[model samples]
Target: MPAPPPHSAGIPASRRAQIGAGLSDSLGVGLGIFPLGIALGVLVVQAGLPWWVSPALAIGVFAGSVELLLVGMLAAATPLVTIAVTVLAVNFRHVFYALSFPITRVRPGLPRAYSVYAMVDEAYATYALMPAEKLSSARMVTGQLAMQLYWVGGGLLGVWVAGALPAPIEGFEFALVALFIVMTLDALRSKREVPSALLAGLAAAVALIAFPQQALLAALIMFTAGLALRYAVTRGAAHA
Candidate 1:
């Protein structure tokens, strides 16, 4: 007769090593955003905004694109509806991500909801790249926990240091834009990702031209169209 299956307790030593590696990968991914986080901190002070809000948003929202938008939106006194709509549209991809993430295999409960809430773009990317054989529940959770701490810690550090920086240093708001460009370029390097980005950009531009009041909505429409196109192409290839 066969022995009992290896439960969570029976995860091999090699698998444990993979979990440690995944955690490290998540940390390295988070480190890439340190400079940008610092820039956000400086901007918080320069914008005459409350510094405490930076870490709170990082802890709560943790969405980089929307956080940057909030900077300008705050100064413009953009309505709550606009902010809410924009953030939801920008992060709409997360809805799809939640469908297939391996962590779901781990059987999450209430703690899983909170963990899933903390799953930012970087975490998703790293977790998505994790090898199937190596993706254990222990490993996924460890990676996500490490990533969340790095993000929150970096933002907090930025907010604290922002208060002490000289006025002249506060002029680096462009760094935030530069960071977004870098991330965009990296993601768009692949042919598969390029179309989606181009579509989103075109939509944003068109919206800016035709419906400035609803630019976010227009971009979202384009994003939906792009995803639809991608799905059609994938299905065609599958049938071929």
Candidate 2:
């Protein structure tokens, strides 16, 4: 008899469909991540660290924007306490993302944990686009896994490209800023989000001018609090 079939082939048609959708949805996500990953890899080398650091951050931290900031800090030889605080401030938004994202499809234990760990902005945006009826636990997890692979793979490729270059290229470090700009524009497609985005931008500008020493942390705190208060007031007004 032939050897046992591979696992993917044995999955149900519906499950297969779900997996395919997940992979397909990740294409646009990969477009954004790949360049950013390349920038990160180049930045890693520019910072005078080993090539391994880029992929290591992509795999270990799995955060794009924050990892960019970390690269700068590592280069400056910044203190660990400041780095810790900055990381917490930047990543604190994930707490809110977790609040609304549906993870019921993920089975318990490590699988479920990985699903949560993989909940980057791209995954969140894709999940929000799908109707409840169209989503399956298998599909959701598969799509997230695919996106993570794209990001990790992109970082590794960037590392390779950086190594191949004759000398470190200047200005590639700005890719992180460009990536965030693109993400913000994509997110602002909804009219309802425009106000919040503007508010956050205002907060960032203020922090940049008034609190340059701790700009990112200050901007994030202001944005978070301002948005929370706006939502609460809106809800209260609606009920009244």
Top TM-score: which candidate number?
2
lDDT of 2: 0.82
For residue 213, what is the lDDT in candidate 1? 82
Q: Model 1 reaches what TM-score against the true structure?
A: 0.73
User: 1-240 in candidate 2: lDDT tens per residue?
Assistant: 999656675787677887898788888888888777877787888888887888788888886688888998888887787688878877877888888788776677876798899888888888965778877777788888888787777777888888899987888777777767887998899899899899999999999999998777678788888999999999999999
Models 1 onward score TM values of 0.73, 0.75
> Candidate 1 local accuracy as lDDT?
0.73
How much is the lDDT of residue 60 in candidate 2?
Answer: 81
What is the C-alpha lDDT profile of model 1 across 1-240, one tens digit per residue?
999667477777777786787577776777776655666666766777888767777777887667766877776777788788778877888888776666664537854776587667877787776667766666677777777676667667877787776654744777767767897999889888887788878878888999898777667777677789888998999999
Output the number of the lDDT-best candidate. Answer: 2
After TM-score superposition, the amount by which residue 44's alpha carbon in candidate 2 deviates from its true location, in angstroms, is: 0.9
At residue 143, candidate 2 shows an lDDT of 83
lDDT of 1 at 32: 70
**Candidate 1 worst ten-residue window by lDDT:** 102-111
Question: What lDDT would each prediction earn against the true structure?
Answer: 0.73, 0.82
